[model samples]
Target: MRRVLALLLLLALPALAADRPPRSGLDYATPGVRAMQADDFANPGMLWVQEGLALWDRPGGMGGTSCASCHGRIEGFAGIAYPRRDPRDPDKLMNLETRIEKCRLDNMGAPPYGYESRELVALTAAVRHQARGRPVAVVEDADAIAAGEKEFRQRRGALDLACAQCHEANAGKKLRDETISEGQTNGFPAYRLRWQGVGSLHRRFQVCNQAVAAEPYPLGSQEYIALEWYLAKRGAGLLVETPAVRQ
Candidate 1:
């Protein structure tokens, strides 16, 4: 009987150890992340910023008129106050990138770039550059807020983990070498050293879902767009850092 009890205790020890939560560390929030929030304008990624600026002024596709021709100086147009509920379509909200595509199609008389395209990336970076100092303030009208919150809390994936499980509950905890952040969207279109390219929040989400063994949703899918709207609102006070910012 004594031998059996000891064997049972030994068998349960590994399970107990596996249940322990991850640890937190300063390394999780990299210096690049801090620099991005403090002063992204001075970051080396601003070279893309210049390219985006030029792209904004250049004509493309069937549209002879540049974004500059209609919107005038992009420097005066800020993009931080976005992800707002569209008055015409209350069921849908518009993020800065979405609004830019709409303007490109309607006002600039050009074909809209596909989501994650270089043209869209450049244009978004250029437009976001104008809002360098502005604090992010995505709208949180009742319906939009409710929908966003639902997406944030819902779990989907083979791992059975929701974004909230890591970003909200275990935020600051370490999973291997990387520390988890609050999953803020302030430093978007950021150049992650790991990725070797500038990418959008949606791209990051896809990577994260894959890491947890979740099926990745298509780019520009309604689910991702909704998630973007939610994340933008969640990081309302953070500043916009565009282009390929080093992570």
Candidate 2:
């Protein structure tokens, strides 16, 4: 019965999407949370933004150079295009965090900030915050996009739910007192009230997997990175809203 229902839900996706186009998760935020997100001072995620700017200028490691040494300050930086196909390794897609890690290790002679660390998340948020208002731009990578879409629709976990069932099919509906969102990634690296701090898109993905009783993938894994790209593509043209506050 459950499987049949899931199949029916899958079949209904076209109609659902046609009726309601994709929208940011912010649309589902409460009035107070929405206000908090709009105000730079009120948003807790700004703390990470500040930290990231500081990290850019703060000298460190054997090279004794800050991120600003190469990329300049965060103030006038353009929006970052990530999950890009690596030039040297075409098969590998490099997300913002991985690129940061590589820069630290190769360019700065510093140890890479492990995934989800405070410093890394702060820097990622800070960079993204600079790109606020610019549309999300992703290069055409057919294979990765297809893989990501498959993952989005694939039912997993003990509950046997796919990401689309909630984020796509029931985006505006309430579930357990919380409104289901489109699971867009534009406002990622944002502050979540539940976390009381900023977090990355991949971290949220892990949380969702766990919520469904599935073993979550490791941070920075190819699977999650591909999904990140797919979400960006799905929400293409949406302005970057890094450090956005979410309930």
Candidate 3:
């Protein structure tokens, strides 16, 4: 069965963790991409940010309340290292996308903006943009961090490669035409040339899972929240680059 084959492939891969501290994907980006990210006008991700800002003011939900009604100006919001334990429900982990959805459902009386939807990505990016240079800092949850670290190391998909293999062990090395980076999460919702649009960290996870022929968990799934929590911890000191451009 495919499961047996995948396990066998996983067993065959090497187990080496990069000893260096975490590095942002920005370091590996091409000059053009870096330039694009640097310039507000040039960054296509800003388009989503614009949309999100407008949406923040527009009335929504059954009550016809806008996000501004409660949260005020989006620019004043501080950056967060999310996928943390939700304050309202300590048992649950909520990322920015989930937080936005929760507000829409519970506060605004609006329908949830499904994961990877343009509106969700825009709002997430807009909020994150406010915290552009802040470092990733969140209260640690040992259980979730450990679970995520395990997920990061485990090999999946038909290729049987673990995330550590490329992002940790072989970072900065060439993988065909492109260089491999240390797979940091400080940047999202980011603009990828391949995607040709802004997308969330979970969207990136799905793409990575699909790349190796593994089944991807649902966006905002607990598994991903845990993985994202681990990644935020791993990239603790890195500054947020919400609209980062990546190859």
Query: What are the TM-scores, per candidate, against the unseen true structure?
Result: 0.78, 0.92, 0.90
User: Each model's C-alpha lDDT?
Assistant: 0.69, 0.88, 0.87
- Winning candidate number (TM-score): 2
Off by over 4 Å in 2: 1-12, 15-20
TM-score for model 3? Answer: 0.90
Error of 3 at 52 (Å): 0.8
Model 2: lowest-lDDT 10 consecutive positions: 13-22
Colliding residue pairs in candidate 3: none
Off by over 4 Å in 3: 1-19
lDDT of 1: 0.69
lDDT of 2 by residue, 54-166 (tens): 88898886768888887776776655588888888889988999999988998899999888999999999998888888887787888998888888988999989999888
Taking the tens digit of each residue's C-alpha lDDT, what string does model 1 give over 1-247? 9999999997786466335442212125578665663565655556566778898889873648887777788877785466675668776667767787877786766788877887677677677767765676576676666676787777888898888778866677787887777677766766676776566667888998888899988765557777777777666656665543544
Where does model 1 exceed 4 Å of error?
A: 1-28, 32-44, 61-63, 243-246
1-247: candidate 3 lDDT, tens digit per residue = 9999989876655432433567899999889999999999999999999998998998987767899998888877765557777887788888889988998998899998898899999999999988899987766789989989899989999999888778877889999999998889988899999999999999999998998889999999998988998888888789989888998
22 in model 2: Cα distance from truth in Å?
Answer: 2.3
